[model samples]
Target: PKDQRKFGYAIVGLGNYALHQILPAFAECRYARLTALVSGDPAKARRIGAEYGIGPGHIYSYENFDSIARDPEVDAVYILLPTALHSAMTVRAFKAGKHVLCETPMATSVGDCQLMLAASKRARKYLMLGYRCHFDPLTLKAVAMLNGGAVGARQVVTTDNSDINVPLSEVAHSWRFDRSLSGGGSLINLGLYGVNGTRYLLDEDPVQVQACILPNKNPLFSSVEDTVAWTLLYKSGAVAHGSSSYTIKDASTFRVLGDKGGLLMDPATSYWANRVSLISGDATQSWGTPQFTLPALNQFSAELDYLAECVARQQPPVRASGQEGLQDMRLITAMYESAHTGQPVNT
Candidate 1:
């Protein structure tokens, strides 16, 4: 018998991530299922829908997206479009009387984020941010350890999220390089992992933000930045340093330090496997590094199930709420401001 209790999700984009990660994750989702697909390309939509057992009637284009309001099977819409389009799509989903699960960096501007939140409130629909790490078992384990004094007193965090270089032709054609579509470049797209991950681990918002654009003379970055670095100051005297680049092959890694000891995670925010090690020392023992082996959980599936559970219970998402996404955009905006003015901005 089918689990009719599962929430139905209408994925609103057919991008690479949506097809590769989000769609596949549905198979592992305990509380959610793919009920519909929205894509501008009819061929892709039909093919994907057929593969997922979604009939042509459930396949929608951007032009007919609002008609989903009449679809009882579509209890929620998952917005996986580019950063700038997140706000508008979310608002429309709310108007259609559907819950929303939007991807991170929320929107291009703070005002856009606020608008999405207001729309959700007005429509009385649930809004969840796609901060997948919050629901990952490994990340949750790290957070629990840090909070449990595994690292005595939190002191510092450093993270770098960079990817392999892209050819000039591809870079020029991708929406990620377009300022209007992406808002910025590597910092907004890649560095968000570092920023959001640090904040979640520490459970504290930065008080001040300072940033600068790194030297990248490539013509590929003309429309947006290629590399950037930022520093965040916490009220507890804690500090975080982060950097990201589109031209660098650096791994997505973060190192957390405390008075007693610290932990380092290489490939921390990767979609696949990750590594974490604890470094602690005492007078008798120089230092001991222990590796942690935790249960593997699909990040996308965990987050989707989490939001579905929240909606099933008619409760707000506690971990990755819309407000959490708004705060990240606010901090990102401040980072941009700081990088432009060469002065620290109060957040």
Candidate 2:
């Protein structure tokens, strides 16, 4: 049955996330299999490919990545490069006649995102964003509840996501601390969880964005902001507030308030382990992790399997499409513009 599947993926980038999370997830995926690997480092790619049971011919370096187009084994390319490389690599993958599943934020700029979308259209290939949280069990339950009117008419949303930044000296080897590579700091890295979460939970996009950047005076953050906060005003008169910081310990949470009821989720956007509760009138209901057909800890696998199904059925992915990622990038750009001008930016 596994051999009957239609999609085979080549993972690009051997970073920590790709090495630890995405690669291992392939073992749990039903429709998606790891067929190839593309990395800047040939040794790492070959080594990892061997471990994953891929042949030497399936391993590619950055310089020869386009050769994958002729490799029948690879039907899709999953990009896990830095923010700066996302756009270029996605376009290249599409040009190589492979469907693409790129990590979130799509690209560093709105223009880059547009180029990626255009490339996908030209190549007639599917392009999906790797927003694994969209496949998380708790997030699914929350979205279903909100859509079913369990929270009544939504009014306000508040989300916060933060984690301490690695020391500058230690981060020098990676592009994460570089302005050109990372695009922005805490907001793009962590606050994006809040941005995307609010949109999904409310099922609406913000019409206006206002923001403030709290730049860390520390020399370590001279290239980017250490903390940032922003507010989103939706067309329906609903509002959402989000904040992110690299100076704080782990704290990821969100709360949704409505006219008839509300929902609160602590550790809302975590990879695992989140607590959610519903509030209505004078009663508080606790809803633990919702049951999923897939393994509780395999969100990455779920995401990959979903994309494989989309490719097999020729159906577009609803939640993690390239358009969805572009929407977030557009809003992120607006948030930065608003922060710089000290005024609200209309989306």
Candidate 3:
């Protein structure tokens, strides 16, 4: 028998990511539903809410967000706000007696991540980070293959997560271009996948970080780095190389090479259609390239159900918890520091 109860989620911030990805995902989630909508725009919220069968009473503005505390239907809040607002919104949600699922780069800094963790502890509610890749079928398969010694002991990893096309007009008005709102540009916005991805696949943290932010001549990138490249060195004698850029054509992929052979994936972190290739064999025999048939999953929906399942079981989201986000923040902070000092920073 399965738990028939579906947990209700109050979607905070009806931004593009929320509207395009998160909201659509609810339809596929078995244990989660969009019971409420929180947006600053009443008209937009009400219009969208109506489409989702959310009544006007369940639609709330940012000023009235705390009122959700009394809405028994909302068991949790999925925070899709800007990077800087994540910490505050998560804290407020917990204070309102609700579990929280916040998007990645948890907060602008390591300190804010700690604050979120503390608030979740005080509320005794679960705090889950939106590391959707963890639930992604393709990502899980790749992790399993690498860790299962399909490629042998992982020695080197390389990845690039970037979307180079952005009109200057959009950049001028987007909060992502504003440092105060987004924390950082390309790296935090798009590159975080590689930074976090390598760690997940290896099941280990980097011991040292060396990084550099590429220079941009464009005026739009004056406030933030247009591109960044980083290296993560591990104690297991493994090295990971990653890069993210707003000026490069679409490139989202990761390659893992071990002593025996290697695995490669192009378009690896996309919302759909991720493919993988593996080359492995013994020195005494010819190499074997096997084909695999993998099922595709809605990344957003899987992540939503993950938290709902945890809530139903009255347990913490240990797999993608706040601590995971905090660790990434620490690594990111170190990368920035290393970039500034022109030296390898120990993590």
Candidate 4:
């Protein structure tokens, strides 16, 4: 018999992103629904569960997370924990026979990414990365244009993503500023967007990476880099430059240059607003907001629906798989190594 029910998701971690963005997105998802929540704080879990109409029995704590395996309502686990905890939590979800959708920067290190992948494979379950941009309307248009020869062969790419940091004391317990918890600072948090964007735009991985971390005297960033810049060199002689900073005001944009034309995206990765332009010779064309088949489109909901469809059809995720995430982690690790050694590292 064909099961026509929506896939159930247990969202682990009641952090800001999960609470604000991911939780609300469940209302818009057609193929997936939030049936459970895992949090370290029982009070917070109970409050959110009440708001979402989730039963108390489906609420789980960090210590009792494994018990989710016995809950028939949870068919998948969305790992939204801190970066360092991603690997262990993902592995545990896989072992529980639940598909995983982990947030980006997958894990703190390449080794942890490998472990997560291995665990997913061992459990014979799908592991998807939560890369919302891959499902964004403007982003999808850019990808299609690049692949359709709108830009010909991409020659160079540049991106900037930055945001002002919160007070050290405020985030001290959140693990964002901890070196061990976050792996790196601006590079891992903000620059990973550029790294992944470059790869998707070029449709190829870089052959070499050169990076440098700008010195910061701020006490708040003693454990992580306050600002960082990196370059990626591709085999086709294409190059990409990316920068991320904690002290800068909010700015997110990327540009791609090719033989025939160029592409520009201002506020490229924002949740709501993004604009793209195509430049060829003296003429410039603007591609306004993209049209979607659905009545309402939320990036998070789309990604969740995509994962659910993949699970329902017994297919693997192509763009946002664990392997794709591992590739970015490897590149990030190499970039950090190159920055530390003051030398270019081969990918």
Candidate 4 per-residue lDDT, tens place, 165-252, comes to 4655576565888888888899999999989999988999999999999988878788989789889999999999989988777878
Residue-level lDDT tens digits of model 1 in 106-210:
999999999999999999999999888887777888888888998788889999999844565676777888899999998888888899988977879999999
Per the 3 Å backbone cut-off, how many clashing residue pairs does candidate 3 have?
Answer: 0
Q: What is the C-alpha RMSD of each candidate to the true structure, in Å?
A: 1.9, 2.4, 2.3, 2.7
lDDT of 2 by residue, 84-119 (tens): 999999989998999999998688899999999999
TM-score: the better of candidates 3 and 4: 3
TM-score of each: 0.96, 0.94, 0.95, 0.94
In candidate 4, the residue pairs with backbone N, CA or C atoms under 3 Å apart (3 or more residues apart, or in different chains) clash, namely: none
Off by over 4 Å in 1: 164-169, 282-290
**Residue 344 lDDT in candidate 4:** 100
Candidate 1: Cα lDDT at 333: 89
* Residue pair clashes in candidate 2: none
| Model 1 TM-score on a 0 to 1 scale | 0.96
Native-to-model Cα distance after best TM-score fit, residue 343 in candidate 1, in Å: 0.5
lDDT over C-alpha atoms for residue 125 of model 1: 92
Residue 178 miss distance in model 1 (angstroms):
0.5
Model 3, which residues run further than 4 Å from truth?
A: 1-3, 164-168, 281-290
lDDT over C-alpha atoms for residue 179 of model 4: 86
Quote the positional error of residue 313 for candidate 4 in Å: 0.4
| Full-model lDDT, candidate 3 | 0.88
